[model samples]
Target: MIPEQRRDFIYRYVHEKNVASFNELAELMNVSHMTVRRDILALEEEGKVVLINGGIKLNNLLKLELPWREKAELNHDVKRKMGELAAMLIEPGQTIYLDAGTSIFEVAKAVAASNCFNLTVVTNDFSISHYLMDMPHITLYHTGGLVEKRNRSCLGKSAANFLSTINIDVAFISSSSWDLERGMSTPDEGKASVKEMVLQVSKRRVLVSDSSKFGKYAMFHICALSQLTDIICDTALPDDACQTLAAQNLKLHLVSTEREQNHA
Candidate 1:
């Protein structure tokens, strides 16, 4: 395999396992021990991993971002609640923008199922467009630009420029991580640009995320909680964080898993 592909494999393997032994990596890659050691040293210089006794551990500071596929499998139940609640907030004949993320994807699904006719849905996510495209009542506009295969979305200046020209009633945005201090953040600058542009152009901005996303910040800053019109998250958010959001006067919508189960 090429160097980038090899490093990506090693990164994913170590990230999934949290820590990996030198022997394990060498065997997995069918490479010599020295070759594996060299690769590990290289990753260390990039601040992606740390060498320990006989193994390497992922850099905790740099572990803030997970690929979209891995992230989609997490917090499914919480995302469902957030999605359902966000869908209820929308009215018929409204133009909406669904930002690229798993939680926002759920919102797209919810909007589609609501049978809301003459709805204009704009998205950069291939999954969301695919989900709503066939519905006759919904008009879908996908922003095309540089494609990030892992996130399965388009980003960069072209996508952001397209969003700027349109009038969005509400935009459902999400990120790889968020913190009270850094606000919303993502690993990719291109993705951050698209999200920032969406927030700037939308009439009402709704941040749809899970509680676990709190207290984590990534490489690029999207926007602070205070900038959002509404924040929708699961109830697992800490009391302190809730207080912070309240202090900022941001509209906070917390969904309870228990309530959803009971209602079901």
Candidate 2:
């Protein structure tokens, strides 16, 4: 099919479902996943639909995107709620850690919006640091390391080593995938180990994730649900998974669906 035809199909599919996954679009247009992805990329450049995790959704033009990758788009709603809950745990003057994830950006937003000024934030995500820059009272410390362009974060042995030295009050982590039976995991081994180090130095390790992470596994395992002191998530999470975490004595903080979020 021609590119014009494919573009039309993309619009049609998105209009019908409000979301279109790469695989679904490929099937509809009888093309390859790479073709679909390329089309989505072109569309994104054209200011059309926003390409998310294997999918596309109508763009929210008003909000300037904060260097988000496709990997972070799967559970957008769940991430917002988790961010709110994570923010509530932060107290004034506390030292906190925020990992590089879309959900974690929400945590950054919540913290920045609050009046509390006596907190130090350590982060590897450039966007998170950028978001907190205007907030006068928050002290920002970045992990000095090689920057990963796709995720827009610092990751390397240097970054991991830097995190090992800092003792923090609480660390809010985000992951791409999780397995209750196995552990929390991520696609990049270097970044996964960075998360592990962040948890090690923090007094309270809070896992902030969405329901889409459940039942999935990544190449590198970070930490187990058992290792987390608590988890914050939205209502889309499965009850069975929650029960599994509970059996491991992990405290689960379920966020209310009604909590307001800064939508994308």
Candidate 3:
């Protein structure tokens, strides 16, 4: 296997086992101990694992967020469907805010594919800005601030301040964690600030996230569920959760991944 695949294997293995010895991982991957050691060191640097007593353990505390590329690989099809559904909400000549995260990145891709014209797109994600930059019909703006390289986005006071000056027609916010109790939250305070500002300035505050992020909670609180005007996510979200959202009179768009797969 290639280095990335090998590292992915090691990460999944260690995550499943919780803690594993060098010998155990090396034997499992059928690679030399040296190779396993190198991979472990790399994972350690990424804060996904920790070395201890000739073994490696998943870093429960520090592994709250995955790098952008890694997160993009997860639930890829589901995110795409969510994106396409979100794109349908856009109208030509409207100013929209796309939040930073893989889920929102998929929305950016869908928006590009939909051939929407004369739209002003604002974002903090470098990836999204680059993707939509050359489109003749779209005007793209990036929020400049302290760069969070891992997620390929900008955050902090500078980014939040930039957002405060703009009025957004629709804001498609992304979050790593959310629930009924804490609402939407993030581990990074800077991200929270930016998202909060987007919600405050936007006319339609829509949240674009996946089913997997539904029950989770992060360290920093952004806003409550009632703050959102709409939520677009995969249909795999739980029934009870759907009922709760309905009770709040929030518009919920649940994209069907299975239907998309069948159409594909």
Candidate 4:
């Protein structure tokens, strides 16, 4: 197997077993111990696993969603660049859906700052709705349901039902955790249902996320990678990860982060 495939195997193996020894993994994959070690190191760098005593284990941190304020602060710059790239896909007269998340909030911010006008913005995020509320040129609609105050979003059967009725020109979706194997996922089924509905009703589906979210998994699956038409992320996304997306024929945009541009 190629390196990417090997790493994916190691990831799944560890995830299933909860913890895996280097010797057992190397034997199971029929690869050398050094090869398994190298793959484990790569996975660790992605924050998907943690090195243990002569073994590796799935990172438990990936299973929980961080609070909104914390997530907003985690990768502020990278999310801004990704949001800028995602916002460029919006047109003046089209209706769009912005999924509830900090990354999608940046997209709303960029759209509000841009020249686009007469656009209708639909969202479940309280923060996004409030951010775009004062813009007279744009029409806004909120998916009202159960308030998930932790993420500052609305979710439930009512929220998902509200999304099913509207046709979206483009939908910018966000995720706390995603990977090649599992696609986009979240810790709550409510969030997953809303996102799943958005994917089904939109003409164009775009995933706006930072590279940090890659190589991670959550408790609930939203949708598979094949469901998306485009993906916007920072250049810190690994080359092999990019190749995996490219091979699937997804439109991938790797924007340069502010830090990278400033250093250049």
Residues 116-187 of candidate 2 have per-residue lDDT tens digits of 678999999998998888788899999979888878899879999999889999998877567776678776
Residue 60 miss distance in model 1 (angstroms): 6.4
TM-score of each: 0.78, 0.74, 0.79, 0.78
- Most accurate candidate by TM-score: 3
Q: Give one digit per residue, the lDDT tens place, for model 1 in 91-136.
A: 8899999998889988988988896778899999998888887998
Model 3 misplaced regions, further than 4 Å? 1-63, 258-264
Clashing pairs in 1: none
Residue 134 in model 3: lDDT: 88
**Ten-residue stretch with the least lDDT total in model 4:** 9-18
Q: Per-residue lDDT of 1-264 in model 3, one digit per residue for the tens?
A: 888999988876664356799998888889999999998898999877889998897664433676798788777888888999999999999999999999999999999998789999999999999999888889999999999999999999999999999999999999877888889988888888999899889999999988767776767889999999999988878899999999996899998866566888
> Candidate 1: which stretches are off by over 4 Å?
1-64, 258-264
Q: Quote model 4's TM-score.
A: 0.78
TM-score between model 1 and native: 0.78
